[model samples]
Target: MAYRATMQEQMIRKGPWLEEEDERLAAFVTLMGERRWDSLARASGLRRSGKSCRLRWLNYLRPDLKHGQISDEEEQIILQLHERWGNKWSKIARRLPGRTDNEIKNYWRTHLRKKVQEQEQEILQRAINNAVNPQDFLLQQGDRSCEDDKSRTSSDILQISDYGFAASPYEDRLFDWISGSSSGINEDVRKHNEVWNMFSSSSYNLGFVSASGDSIWDYNSSSSSWNLDEDLQVVKQTWNTQ
Candidate 1:
């Protein structure tokens, strides 16, 4: 029959820091300097350790600190820099104006870790799919012979110039589709937005065939996709009306 503990070990405090505490810490650090952190903490009337005082001063109390949500471009730059230098946040922070090393380091842990995990999961899923569909990997083109003439005509019409998804899994199929379209699907990009949207990832850009035989229609949006003949008809009617 042991009784419940009389009190919790520690009380949890949240919300914005108080103004008096901020002012006291700021004034003490400014007047006393870094080496005498213990003395400064006691003089300033803040019940914190020397190490905690130093961290708070550099990480939060500093004048040039950037706070709140990081923008997309900032995120991209951080990722690229991190790959180049690994976990050297201080080195990375020097390149980013108005940012701090600790802030950047925390952001990497919170955001970059999740992105890297997602990429790894996507790769793992691809590996699983390839393993399950063993035959799909070996077969380059499903209907190569039946499409020879059609492919040739599509090549003639689309004026297909350059393609980037050349090494894509669907290289042969994409080439065949372009060749068969008589409408000139001369898509000259490795990443075809139209076809790429159908699957998680695509190497082909089979968006459309331009009249000039040098352009291809692309599917670049979430709301639209290709339906071949029927959709093509609807598109033509809509285009004419517009």
Candidate 2:
């Protein structure tokens, strides 16, 4: 953190702010609210740019500056404000009480994305774990919805491996999810996916009928069709010789 003003107060010319100069600026803003950085700079006899003064005061000296990782709640406001206004750090900073827009933007770039990725990975891992050794509840769902329909079975059920789930919100619910932009895309994405799954799933329906029902389908689409009464001869040819 470079000092915004020179420290000596040597009545010196401006090159950069020093430690002592920072102390003076702090004293000035403390004595009076930072109404005008230009006025503060001149009155303090620092002779620095008003923008510099403002930035110094706001970014550094203002009795506010909540440093060290903005809270999740504060982060939401920052992202929302940034999205709506777009990179006007000053404007965004105003909406925040003690946070700087630069801090917010930087955090968004470096930390936020990583945080989101980590969270997503955790969710994906959780889902994968659940899929393998699914709890009685999810298992019951499989039993009732998929297995009950003799025409289809959980044996042919799709795994997370079969088709990766993207985090984008499925449309019908975007109206609900985007409404909470402050809450963020990932949160809404989960809700969106849940809703999509709820709607898309009732009874698993196979896209193509196997010409032979007894064949062990490898999910090969081109050779997918097999006779209903007979084992899929194509699949049987490879696995079951009898």
Candidate 3:
């Protein structure tokens, strides 16, 4: 028990620090320029470790530190930079001025990471839901698109095929509707292409069965036509026959 007591006596202070301790830490950092934390802690007359003193100075006592909650812009930057660099908090902190690596790491752990995880879970659930009942999901999206027409620009809204066929028969029809020379087809084509690009880049299988049995999305120069009505009519007639 004597060895344990000696160890305890030698142990540096931990947990919440005092106001005077904060000042001494800050003063030591100001004078010493923060290069040597152990020396700074000794000089400051604090029973705290070098690591603790350094963290307090960098995260709290620093004059250039930004107080208050992170703004939407900062949050967005953090999310994007984290996506690119993974858990390299210091690298991410460089992009966000007045923010410490420790602060960013804490913020990500407490808030942003959970939000991202929840979003991923939601997307996974949607994918599963889509797999189980694709027609229902498409119809729901179609209905929502129609209902929210006034809120979105022409290009921002999800476009469904006007042809009132079931999901299996309407896959190619939807592609044609986007690519064709209909009044709003150009905007629809742009949005559809964006979705297609996202899916392709992510390698997400959307399970789009081609009604034509050739290719549903043939946007190549030779295959693309402003007028695909004749082919659509043939598809319609074939669907009617079946």
Q: Compare the candidates by lDDT and give the number of the best one.
A: 3
lDDT of each: 0.54, 0.53, 0.60
Best by TM-score: 3
Kindly list the per-residue Cα lDDT of model 1 for residues 160-216, writing each as its tens digit: 333233233243343344334433212311122233333212122234333444324
> Taking the tens digit of each residue's C-alpha lDDT, what string does model 3 give over 121-239?
77668968668554455456554645633433322222212211222223345445433533442354343444334332211222222234433343211254423566456544643
| TM-score for each of the candidates | 0.43, 0.38, 0.50
lDDT of 2: 0.53
Q: Kindly report which residue stretches of model 2 are placed more than 4 angstroms away from their true locations once superposed.
A: 1-16, 31-33, 113-242
Task: Write the number of the candidate with greater TM-score, choosing between 1 and 2.
Answer: 1
Candidate 3 TM-score versus the reference: 0.50
- What global local distance difference test value does model 3 have? 0.60
Q: Ten-residue segment with the worst summed lDDT in candidate 2?
A: 164-173
Candidate 1 error regions (>4 Å): 1-17, 124-242
